[model samples]
Target: MEHAELDALLTPEAMTLLDGLDPVQTTNDVARVVTRLRAAGHGPELVSAVVGQSRLRHRAAAKFGEFAGRMLFTRAGLEQATRMSVSAHHAGRFARAGLRRVADLGCGIGGDSLALAALGLDVLAVDADEVTAALAAYNLRPFGDAVEVRHGIAETTALDGVDAVWLDPARRTTGHSETRRVRADDYSPSLDWAFELASRIPAGIKLGPAHDRDALPEGSEAQWISVDGSTVELVVWTGTLARDGVGRAALVIRGGSAHELTAPADTPDEPVRELGAFLHEPEGSIIRARLIGDVARSLGAGPVAEQIAYLTGDADARSPFATTFRVRETLPADPKPLARALRERGIGTLEIKKRGVDIDPAEFRKKLKLSGTEKATLFVTRIGARRTAILADRLE
Candidate 1:
């Protein structure tokens, strides 16, 4: 098409071509639109024009996902920190705590605030950026007389007589870097300062899940939450984290493999139990939460090492905390014995798992020409610094 023709189509005609293609402003989504345009033979010039105009539109459409009032949080809160889904239970933790009035500091599109508002609480949602604040207001508008979205700095924003607070500091600036780390005293609209301004209220400030554990504040409950076998976020609750972390918090999203783990206090050190016919590898969440004691207590088992998450039992103990398998054979952690054991079992295509052993499965699999009609889960580890393997099967 000629330049004039393209210009002619630039009106409603061109608009119709891009209709329903409301692409998001995110770099990823905008790139996707550009890729699609490329496939349509819309050259770089046309693509650049679309990106400048349609990127934000695409981001909005993508996030909303055809659902009304789909709560959107800051990308830093969700993406940068490994959080994917904000479980209903998590949302309720803050909402049910009698937080009648809340200043959702750095409220990215109002994810948490909406939940609070849904609970019939009056919330003041604030974000630093003008565009984000506008989007937040647009998203929160349906609540009607419940949620008020504002564009301003949390440190200077007028936060008068609010009940509680939720501040998710901007971990990174747009140009990108760890540029924002406001102190509790420096908290926007300054809740840290506001405690003096008004009253001390329950606050939930989300930081990196990988944050220094030892630095955890006194009496602050640290919660590591995961959904569908993936660790999502670590939250520090100034007041209430949960009833009893119970070692593992499996946030199941219906038909998904539940995320499970044991808490730090739950780590087991009650002396290593004797090796049994079965070896169990505790799920990752359990390892992080240090819920081995809880898992052992639940499975009626004990740890193979004082520190390792691996649990052992004389009889098979079925547990979600660990993958349990019945034993078919055993050998020293050395290669010759392992090779012989595999040959005897006629087992090949080995599924290697290790808790304490440093032996590489790739190097070992190359040595064992094994195949079998029967199988077992091998618990590879160092028993008193001597490598060992305990073959086992899934506990019924």
Candidate 2:
């Protein structure tokens, strides 16, 4: 959105009109809403802007919940904004460190800044993009004097009186129409500069989950977080912000519950063992954090194969860190034989899962010729050096 469009969106009349309209949740809904809005005497620009915003608010609900209803967002800003649940955890880190004021570098749409202000920390939220900074100012207006949104580069933003820093360098290429992922070295403030600043002050840097681990600065706590079942982001905490004696950790959030596993360093995986009565699929956070050994130990299990993330043991052992499946039987790895075997067993419905393999599940499913009344999950992966398939039932 341009400055004038944003100004229009923030006006009393525009806000009142937006408030009176229900959220547009789908593309089909957008057409009907846009038509009704235009017919109601709203100008074309206002209708288009409001309609676009309504759709964004509906999409943002997954990340910001009810707060999305009142916030302003751009397409790219909303796409890159941190989830509210994760931001709350980030804000709590500053709160626990006794930090009262924080410099939120590269604070897109004030997502983290909002969380910080909610925790009572004064925030200086900065974004280099003019429109984004303005949108951030609007979004953070509810915080009153607690937040100051500035249009400035994070590298040059004044840091006076800031007790800590929360730097989320722009990881995507700059564009007015589209943005694409850039490498770690290409970060807006750059990882080198970000880590240098962190070395001098307590700071938390948010990076993508796939960021090169070897490049992470020493003496920091690297944490991988998974919300629901997806590995969302990796945050490296430095100085006092880093948790004591914790070098690496995985935080899994499902529903409203959180479970964390940490180690002073990466732990060695348990020895590979034969497939037992059950199979365990570790959460993405656990796999990314390389803490599968910890989960395996807790469940009295071991890896099903070398270099594989799957774990196996008795059917009774369970942990929040992994999804356990009861082993029904092993199936033939060959497609024709596997299809025939499944047909004989009366298994029709299937949930296909794979790791350490190249076959696309959707394409492979079409070749199965599935037919039956029974339903089951099929795990296509490796056991030692051999390709294997395991049919199982999901244990709730």
Candidate 3:
């Protein structure tokens, strides 16, 4: 970020410059007017206004960044933290589940740490950056009395015996931001590092939902956790871990509904796609736990193809594994003819779901000129040796 860029984003000092407010000045006007006030000497009134808006804007941006982080990191793009509020039962569940005496390895702004503390858990949250650590401490101050914020790299921190350790590794490389990656071995607190600690005590490691299954360590309970139907983070549990028939669980928050599903673990070298009356793509947890079979069995569904995560059956199934989309029509895959047919059907809104094949969804939608028509599910995959797209609608 350059100095000019920094000016665009409010610095702590820039925020202090806007003081006081008219009861009537809207937030937008305050920000815009504050920009002008910066040129004139800042008075006590202007400074107060800036501080008030500063607090609001800081919190909003932090919330947004955290939301984006959770989405991109999860399999189903789950929203971990939100203004929507936490579930009371879910809050107590983590506490009842022996997550107390917690060690939040990378407590980014204390989102999880705060949630844990709210449930009466004693959290020893740690972070590497002095700035972030300070900010985390400030954010967590409201939890009061129970939470202790520390500053250090968790990989090097001495955690002799904690009830449960949370390993949220830092993926940012030395300089360039694009250097972000998900190398288990290279994280500041690598997966191996977390797993090694977990081997000693109960530990939960948060990983990218798009992780490779072949790389998972033995003797760990792998869970694909989702919130509100969207698969969020992959949780690896070691010690006291159970091999749930299905690895994927739709973790319903608070007093809301919760669904736990599983999938069969697949042999990577022998990949296959399952098709049926309804094809349910189990969440990552189901895939990693290799419990897809368990989910299909529970739903009375069968595999469309042998190894593919997709399941099929003559009956409509209610499973958290996948959204139920009915087969409105089925035909062979031909881009030009399919587009023409769709255009005639007045179907312009498309959701291209791809599995075995590699075709860009955006490019396909653009080429098809999808707009102002209708919504439909497009499945692009390979059957035998050819790839095709099947347009369908929600089953129920």
User: What are the models' TM-scores?
Assistant: 0.65, 0.97, 0.74
Runs of candidate 2 with Cα error greater than 4 angstroms are none
TM-score-better candidate, 1 vs 3: 3
The runs of at least 3 residues in candidate 1 whose Cα sits more than 4 Å from the true structure, single-residue gaps closed, are 1-78, 81-85, 118-120, 128-145, 169-199, 240-268, 331-352, 357-379, 390-396
Q: lDDT: which candidate is best?
A: 2
Q: Which window of 10 residues has the lowest lDDT sum in candidate 3? A: 69-78
Candidates' C-alpha lDDT? 0.59, 0.91, 0.58
Put down candidate 2 lDDT per residue, 207-301, tens digits, no spaces: 99999999999989999999998999999999999999999999999989988999998998998889999999999989989999989999999
lDDT of 1 by residue, 1-396 (tens): 233333433455345545546645577877787888789877676565445435433344332334321333333332332222353444576666766787887776566676677677788999876655665685688888788888897777776878767767655543111245544444344334433332245666665445556655554555665444454555656643333443224232313344445343545444588776666666555555556677777777787775676777767677765667666656766777777877787665567777666768777767665677665566677777677777666665
Question: What CA RMSD would candidate 1 show?
Answer: 7.3
**Candidate 2 Cα lDDT to native:** 0.91
The lowest-lDDT stretch of 10 consecutive residues in candidate 1 is: 247-256
Candidate 3 lDDT, 47-75, residue by residue in tens: 44344434444444433443322211111
Cα miss at 258, model 2 (Å)?
0.3
Query: What does candidate 2 score on TM?
Result: 0.97
Please identify model 3 stretches exceeding 4 Å from their true place: 1-94, 174-179, 228-230, 240-256, 262-277
